[model samples]
Target: MGRRPVHVVGRVIVGLLALALTGCAAPAAPADSALSLGSTAAAAPVALTASATAAARTAKIYSIRTTDATKGVITVIGTLSPAPKTGTRIPLHQWIPSARRWQEVAHGYSSGTSVTIKTVQPGSVRTYRIAVGPQAPYAAAISPMISFKHYVWRGIFKKGLLATGGNATPQFNIVPPKEGPRRAEADLLADKGGYVWGEVNSTGCSFVRNWLGNLTDGTVRTSLHNGRRR
Candidate 1:
């Protein structure tokens, strides 16, 4: 081939060099797009953590009450708002007058949102509440305080004919079924000349007891039997 012009050769060489440089130097991604990608990746874990914390904070304790006052028994209940991923532990707190602070008395674990805990009867009156410890997506919570006392049954007496000889009927202060038939002590009074008979009902007893009394010439006679005595 005939020798090419210097200018033409120079132009071809420059064009080839320009093409190579363009291929080697690829276009860079937009600054905004690159920065946005990095930011999204970095915030993913934080967003998840915040969501978990919020879910845990929403959990709460709602209600607690005395189920069996006479037995010193109590029931504690609560709701887990959105519910937790796993079971949660519940603890019972009692106010100690001597200590002047709350003390943990009992604890239990639950799997569902609705929880119920029953406590064994205590020896004395006590103020109590229920608490739930942190369970990841379920936060810690506490219930309202409740007080319980041993139940007592009193007698209601009806007397007829005050002098000479008379009859008296007695009713007991009892919440049927719950309190049921119980053992009790009562003071019987017989003035002048008359007969007194009454039934006593109380807690911690399975059977009922009745008493009968007779008075004459300023003397009193007492007896106890399944049926009325004369």
Candidate 2:
């Protein structure tokens, strides 16, 4: 009757209070669980860092000049400031007549602030440039392009070439350097851009051919009328 209703109401109130107590007691895990995940660990902020400065940079190069000497040799002279670091090598580039671009040929370390570079004189008139490579804070710099050419050995084919033949047509030939991706006759022509280190002379008695065979030791031998002539 009336007691039963009151008892039921009392039980309902106790259940509601127990539910509120459990809700407050339990801790939230969504935020904390997310932070503990492996993916979140990778996004952590980096720690701050600091240190002191080091010696001031002091590297510079100036003025490049090339001179042609006897026996196909060229001397390159230049100056550097603050002395170069040991193992610092300077680069020399030569212009490719066909490609119309520059390519590095040789490199060497400097001798104190003044640099003396010796290179085989170019076989033909060519252009050269000195490049100072970039070092950390410094940017790369290049020297004024210098042109080098040897005085043409003057002669009117004085000991000239005359083709010889019996009852047939004569033959003439021109040879070029051996090593390259492609062989070209551009250097063998007799035009303004050509070079000659030897000439041919022939008469009806027989056929005589003279040509320059560059030896490994920088000395050239000429095959004359009879045999090998220096």
With a 3 Å backbone cut-off (N, CA, C), the pairs that clash in candidate 2 are: none
lDDT tens readout by residue for model 2, 1-230: 98999999999999999999888765655666676675755444322111112222333334333354323455666555545655568877888889999988766677776566667653467887766666644455566677765432212232443433222232333323354212112222232322333334322222322334442344433334442355
Worst 10 residues of 2 by lDDT: 46-55
Instruction: Give residue 114's error in model 2 in angstroms.
Output: 2.0
Which lDDT tens digits does candidate 1 get at residues 152-196? Answer: 232212122122223543222323443433223334554445455
Error of 2 at 169 (Å): 29
Q: lDDT score, residue 210, model 1?
A: 58
